[model samples]
Structures are given as C-alpha cells and as structure tokens.
Target: MSTPVRSSPLALTVLALLHYRPLHPYGVQRLIKEWGKEQVVNVGQRASLYRTIDRLSAAGLIAVRQTERGSQYPERTVYELTAAGRDTARAWVREMLAVPKREFPEFPAALSNLLLLPREEMVEVLGERAEALDRELAGLDASLRAEGERGLPRVTMLEAEYLRAVTAAEAAWVRSVVDDLRTGRLTWTEEALRAFGDAGT
Candidate 1:
C-alpha cells in the first residue's frame, strides 16, 4: 500500500487552469492575472510556476506539447492536463471543499500585539484593517456576482463564488475581532504576552 502524494497549492492551481484548456506558461500567467485582475498574481514568479508544472508533469498529471514558433524563442511548451491530471484536479477540489479551514495567523498575531499598543492607537489600527478587509470583500463580492450574472461557464463561476465566500467569511471574522476590540471583550494578560514574545524568539 503506497501513501498518496499531496499536491502543492500552486500545482493544483496550475492543474486547474490547464484543465480548462491547454496553454503556454505565458497564457497561464495571463489567465491567472485576468481572473484576479483586482489582485494580480506576480507572474514574475515564473520560475516557481514552471517548477510546479515540472513536478506535475513528473507525476503524470500534466503533459507538455511543444510548438516551434519560427525563430525568436525556440519551441514553446504548452501544458495540458492528462486524464490523470483531470482526476487529480477533481480530487483536489473535493478535498479542499471537505476540509475545515484553519484560522490564518496574521490576524491573531496582530490582535495579540494590540495589548502592547495604546488603546486608541490599537483601535485605529484594527479599524483600518477591518476597513481594508471590507473593501476587498466588497470588490470580490461584486466581481463574483457580476460574473454570475454574465452566465460564465460553470467552473469559472464556481471558482469566483468560492473566492467570494472565503473573502466574505474572512471579512466577517475581521468584523467580529474589531467588535471585540471595540467592546473590550478581548484582552491579553501579561504572562500570555511574555509567552507570545518568547515563542516568537
């Protein structure tokens, strides 16, 4: 009995993109950018993307088909997900949907450090963060809703809907934290503060 290999997030993302259609690396980068227009992925991280693609290829999840483009840049390697890759992508999607999400640390860390800050200053900082999150959530929600209204393909609309849900959940969590801070419901003791600092060091 062999243990199954887990896919990296980037690998899964690449596979998902390729599952939609075959594309060169540049096309993949462009599609990702278009999908996340408001919050662009730095496609400058080509090395990292290609490395994940290589890993996926080795795993038989994707295949490279080469096309010679006359002179300038040799043959371009366009990637397409294999049958295995499609299955893997579907499995990844199911796994992601099934798993309970863990809380991300950045928000908790900021909250923990707030006790060391002046009350007014802490409130101001948290307020700013909350506002930013709200704005982002609003943008994501609008985009998803608009995409939905336009009757985009099922997978594309589903992806946008998933993003919107996640963003909304995060925004709600942020609002709750801000409310706690505003209402003095949350606090940190000195010992806990010391422990946090020690753990960081």
Candidate 2:
C-alpha cells in the first residue's frame, strides 16, 4: 500500500507518546494534558482521539499491545507504535521543524486590507495590537521563567521561546509603522491618494 498520511497533530502526538511506552487511550489523554502537549495537539474530544487511534491502526503504524479490564471501568485497548510508525514520527517532526507552511492568520489578513482605513485609524489599531502583543510576551516570559525554575530544559520549551521572539519582532515592526504614520514619514500625497481612488473606480 501507498504510504499513509501521518499529518494529523493527534496522530503524531500518539506516535510520540507510544514511543515512550504503550498506553491506553485514557492514559494518552492524561499524559498529553499533563505535559501540555494538548496546546499544540488537538485532542479536544475523546471520540476524535479514538478515531485517530483507529486510523493509525488501520494504516499499520500502531498496533494493540494489550487490553485492560478494571472492575470500576470498561476495557481499554492499549497501543504501541510499529517500527514504521516510529520512523514516520521522526520524519514528520523533522519536516515540520524545517519547513514553514503558509498559514493564513488573521493579522496578515487584516494587514492586507489596512488601506481601507485612514492612516491615523490604522495607526491606532496597530498600536492596540502592539500593546496586546506586549502583554502576551510578558506572560510568555513569566511562563518560561517558571519552567526554567522547575528544571525544564530550554530545548523542551523551544516552541514558547520561538513564540516570544516572533511576538517581540512583530510588536517592534508595528511600533515602527505607527511611528512613521504619526511623523508623516509614510504619509500619502493628495495626488497619489486621488490616483489610487480613481484606480479603484
């Protein structure tokens, strides 16, 4: 059979967890939440988690390691990754880290239509966004500090580090743009504005 697509966040997460040890679905759920992997992996619903498990099993990426029965609860099937699954997970993680996908986030969408607003209004809105980003960066800083104090390695929290850096960069760029708008450094001339309006019509 052709290679199965191993692109789902949930699927990759399951593979990574199983690489440590075989786990039942409930165990997987708990571990993901406990490790904060749920922030990056979408394991919101139990049904969806089960479905992902089923798909991986069907694709020969994972297999049933055992079934557990408890007097207080129903039987749960535990799963472990096949050799192919382990290799796929490593490849998937490598590609994801190396490749930047074109993500259509709302900020860029609004930025593209910024000319619809007056320059002053755009400056005001972008100023607000910069303030929000500042708050977010502060929170991230606090979280990183706490994690570091708790002995979490810098490598383990790299995603948070990347986010903090990206937010700082964006906030700096927005501040520069706002400054340009306020100082007439990036103002539009009447003739050019009229030409643009005419072109729109």
Candidate 3:
C-alpha cells in the first residue's frame, strides 16, 4: 500500500491546474502568477513547487504525458491529472470548504507575548502594525477594484475578495487595540502581571 499524499495548498493547486490540461512545472508557475493565485498559495520558491510536483507524481495522482525539448530551454516534462487526481482534487476542495482547520499564525503568537514588552514599546509597535495593515488593506482594495473593472467574474476572484475582507477586519481590529492601548484602557503593569501569575498558583 502507498502512503497517502498530504494535501497542501500547492499540491492542491497542482492537481487543479492539471485537471484543465497537461502542463510543465514552468507552465504551472506562470499560470499561478498570471491568475493571481500567488497571494493565497506560497510558491515563491521554485524548488518548493518542484518538490510538490514530484510528490504528487510519486503518489500516483499525476502522470507525465510527455517531455519536450527546445534549443533555448531545458527539457520539460508535461504532466496530466490521472483519474485518482481528479477525484482527489474534488475531495480536497469539498473538505477545504466544509472544514476549518486550526492554524497557528505568527501574529497571534506575537500578540500572546505582547506583555513582555513595556507599555510604551507595545503602543509604538502596535501602532506601526496598524499602519502596515492599513497599507495592506489598501492594496487589496486596489487589486479587487482593478480586477472588477476588468470584468472578471466574482466567482473567479472569490479568494481575493475573502482576503480583502480578512485584511480589512484585521486592520480595523488592530487600530482599535492601538487606540485602547493609547487611552490606557487595555494595559498591564509588571506588578499586575506578577500578581496575576501568582493568583493562578
């Protein structure tokens, strides 16, 4: 028996692209950027993309259709989705849509440790974060507006829309926290922290 192929964002994307047509690794990377999937999928490193492709091939989800050679470029192997791959892709989409997995992101982790910093430093840092998030939210709005103006279907850009919503929410939340911190509504002193920890004992 073969080990199950782990489903990662990149692996799932590889399967989905192969479902449309056979493509080489370079083609996959090109389409990802052109289609604006890079925001949600982490394929900034070519090596990681190649690794995911190799794993999918090994798992029997995808098969090589042919290899092409050109004078100016290195030989490229084109891959197509197998029957198993098509089924797996659909299953993954359903699972992803139906379930929300617990994920640990850096921002939350940092928020957990914010007490380690002095109040003034925390205010300064969080204020900076609010500014940065505002910038990010602006970029997402611009992208969404540009694509909408181009007459792209909303369905095709659902991920971007979701990201924009999430960014806007986080920006608003961060700004609120900064305001509270500045107003001394949300803050902790070292003695208070020590006493709180002792109370837990």
Top candidate when judged by lDDT against the true structure: 3
Give me the runs in candidate 1 sitting further than 4 Å from their true place: 1-5, 37-44, 71-74, 101-104, 153-155, 169-201
lDDT of 3: 0.91
1-201: candidate 3 lDDT, tens digit per residue: 334789989999999989999999999999999888998999999999999998899888999999999999999999999999999999999999999989999999999998888878888998898889888888888888888899999998999989988988888898888889889899667799899899999
TM-score of predicted structure 2: 0.80
Candidate 1 local distance difference test against the native: 0.74
Question: What TM-score would every model get versus the actual structure?
Answer: 0.72, 0.80, 0.95
Sorting all predicted structures by TM-score, with the top scorer first, yields 3, 2, 1
lDDT of 2 by residue, 89-193 (tens): 998889888998778989999988888998879989999999999998998898789889899878888877888899999999999999998998987677997
lDDT of 1 by residue, 104-142 (tens): 767777765566787677778767876887887788778
Worst 10 residues of 3 by lDDT: 1-10
Q: By TM-score, is 2 or 3 better?
A: 3
Per-residue lDDT, model 1, residue 185, is 94
Worst 10 residues of 2 by lDDT: 1-10
